[model samples]
Every structure is written in C-alpha cells, then in structure tokens.
Target: MFKQLIPIALIAVCTPALAAEPMVVQVKRLSLDTALKIAQGSIAACREKGIQIGVTVVDRDGTVQVTLRDTIAAPITVPISEQKARTAVNFNAATSAMKDRANSPIGRIDGLVMSAGGVPILVGGSALAGGVGVSGAPAGETDEECALAGVAKVQEDLDLAM
Candidate 1:
C-alpha cells in the first residue's frame, strides 16, 4: 500500500509542473534580416559621430552579411576591416585585444594582428555569428568603439543582454 501511494504522490507533484512549462527551442544565431539591421545600426552610430567608417558584418564562418562604407571613407578600409571582424569572430574575442597580443613577441609567434576593431557575435555564450569591424576612423581604438556600438545595437535588436 505504501509503494502504491508513493507512485501516486510522485505523479501528482510532477504532472502540474510539467504542464506549466512552456516549450522552448534553442536558437543559435540572428536571421539575415536581423544581421543587416545590426550592421545598419552600427553604421548609423558611426555616422552620428562624424566618423567616416567602413563597417563589415560577417557570420560565424566569417561570411559577409552586410557591409557599408561611408562616402568619404577610404576603399582599403573595407577588406582590412572585414578581416578584423572575421578574426574576432573566429577567435571569440575582440580583434583589438587579439591584435595587441599579436604585437607582442608571443603574438608574433602566434602570427596574429594586434589592432583595434573586431568583436565576436555570441548568443547564449555560443558564437552564433561574426561581429562588426570599423576602420578609417581617427585611430584603431576609434574603429573598435564604433564596432562595439554596432555590436550593441544588434544585441539590443535581438533582445540579448550581451
């Protein structure tokens, strides 16, 4: 009789709780439209700052999603900025941080660039997409700041805290 009662009690406690839970799906990355919107936001921020920046956004694989260059920005800023964004995404760290390390002897051994700009796109602590890179600003740090602005804009759009 006690064994039968225990099973009944367990079912009573578990059933309602299970029924109350909502179904969930794990989403890994932003949609293409969302990604483009993120890029646009970054560009807007850069423009507002009066910085002629070139911005590049890539997927986790370093594939370009949306790229924009201010009318007065240099053409060469495009590829280099893209590379910075790609490097950050691939390593899951800011490109500027990596570039700083690359400037060191150990960094040389690792053969990395230690410049500013480039940030990783993470969702749920996982790298879901690539980040934005800005170049043709006043300095490397300026590039990074704009890139960060872009990242933040996208994160907000996606309702992500990070």
Candidate 2:
C-alpha cells in the first residue's frame, strides 16, 4: 500500500510538468500608416453620410494607433471614439457586439463600454490588429456603418489575402 501511494504521488507531481504549454497565436501587426488610412476611410464614410465624426484606431493590445478628430466634431466625441476603439480591441469584437453584451449583467464591469463605432481588425480569422471607431454620430448604427466602411477600405487597400 505504501509503495502504491508513493507511485501515485510521483505521477501527480510529474503530470503537470509533462503537460503541454498553452498555444499562443501570433497576431499580425498593422503598420502605423495603414492604421491611419483606415481611420481616414472611416472619417470619409461618415462625412459622406453628412455626419461629423471623430475616428480612432487602436492596436490589438488596445493601444492607440491613429486618432482623427474632425474640426466640427463634438469634444466628447474624441474620448468616445477612443473608448469605442479600446472596447473593440480589448473585447476582440465589434463595438456593436460589445454594446449588445453591455446590456448584460456581466458587461457591467468597471472598464467596459458597449457603444457602437468600434470594429476589430482581423486577418485569417485571427484578431491581428485593431480597428476604426467613429463617434459624434446620432445613432450606433450610423457609427457602425462608418466603421465598417473604414474596415472595408483597409481590406481593399491591402487586398488582404484573408
């Protein structure tokens, strides 16, 4: 019984050591110029809709990539755009999805924002980069439309392989 117990203990101790390491997927990085272009496209889309908006892009880690605040945009729109961009990168989902989840109990956490205008930059099904965020628009859908348009521009510009 003692020998059997010793073997069991050894097996338990060695099991964790033999376990495989967690897989880490590397996300592709978007160049600063490309990030700016994406933001610009988003702004253009909003402008075409007659909306004065602030656009912000962030990296996958939620760091600011480019920020474009229109001259006529509301002051609050600046931070709101940044918040939406951060929300998208942090959550790895579009701002619209974040908004939907925000209405849920779990979304009430201290640092989450669920507003629209945030979109994730994805490549090959992997969230390799971040996306454009538009604010100073009347509705979430309007903001989302602009953001999606911006993403489309980036996709078209790069002719993304994905």
Candidate 3:
C-alpha cells in the first residue's frame, strides 16, 4: 500500500507542473555575414602593414563562423587564428590578456592558448557575441590591432543588426 501511495503522490505532484506554461529564453548569436566581414577587415588591416595573415571569427559558443587566409600566410596560421578566437570567447576578454588569468588553476586548463591576437566581440551590457583572432602578424600587438580593425569595420553593422 505504501509503495502504491508513493507512486500516486509523485504523479499528483508532477501532473500539475506539466500543465504550467513553459518559459522561453532568447539567446543572442553571431551571423555568418558579419563574421566574413570581420575576417576581411582584419586581413586588410594586416595587408596595410605588408603582412600576410590569417583571420578567424567564432560565434559565442566558440564555433568557427568564418576564416580567411592571405595568399602568403602559412597553413599553420589557420588553426592558430581559430584557437585564438575560441580562447577569447572562452575567456570573455582579449586573448592577449589571458596570461594574467592563466595564473589560476582553472585558467591553466588544457586546450586553451593564453596567447595574443584574440579579441572578444561584445554587445550590449558587455555580453559576448563572438570573437575575432588574427595570426601571422609580426607581433602580438599588431595582430590585436588587426582584430580591432575587424571589429571597427563592422561596428555599425553590428549595432544596427542588434
């Protein structure tokens, strides 16, 4: 009798909850068009300095949205750029600044490269929308500059879309 009562009680409690309205959530995401523009702008910025490079853009979830490689850029640059973008998104800051965070145990986790050349794409209230990473520049600062150019190029577009 006690076993039967337990089942009945569970059902009674769950049935009413099932009848309640489900909640909805809205999640912000990055578009591929914007990602492409970021890549192009970053590459162009580096080209101005006579440096051929690779650029990568990733969505908020750290998924690759677009990747661009200059004609003379090394193949290794592709992964480096992507990794940098992912790192930035994961850290919610520029990848170049990740070294400071890496002083903690959690920041030292494997698969995260606390290197330069990565910048987070933030939206309203500093929410992360995606990230952009530039690789193959002569210096990390230059790489970050290119990434900043990429964001600037699409700032208006992103604001309008958002």
| Cα RMSD to the true fold for all candidates | 7.2, 3.5, 3.6
- Across 1-162, the per-residue lDDT of candidate 1 in tens digits comes to 998899999999999999898799554555778777766766777788887878888887778888888888899888877877777776788877775467567555332345787777776556456677777877888888777777776675454533
Candidates sorted by lDDT, descending order?
3, 2, 1
Encode model 2's per-residue lDDT on 68-92: one tens digit a residue.
9887989888778888888887878
- Supply candidate 3's per-residue lDDT for 64: 92
Off by over 4 Å in 2: 1-26, 156-162
Q: Cα deviation in Å at residue 126, candidate 3?
A: 1.2
Q: Write the per-residue lDDT of candidate 3 for residues 1-162, one digit (tens) a residue.
A: 998899899999998888785677577887778888889999999999999999999999989999999999998889889988999998899988777776778667775667789999987538789999889987988999999999989887677766
Q: Looking at candidate 1, what is the lDDT of residue 68?
A: 83
User: Against the unseen true structure, what C-alpha lDDT does each candidate score?
Assistant: 0.74, 0.80, 0.87
Task: Say which candidate scores most in lDDT.
Answer: 3
Give one clash count per candidate, in the order shown: 5, 0, 0
Clashing pairs in 2: none
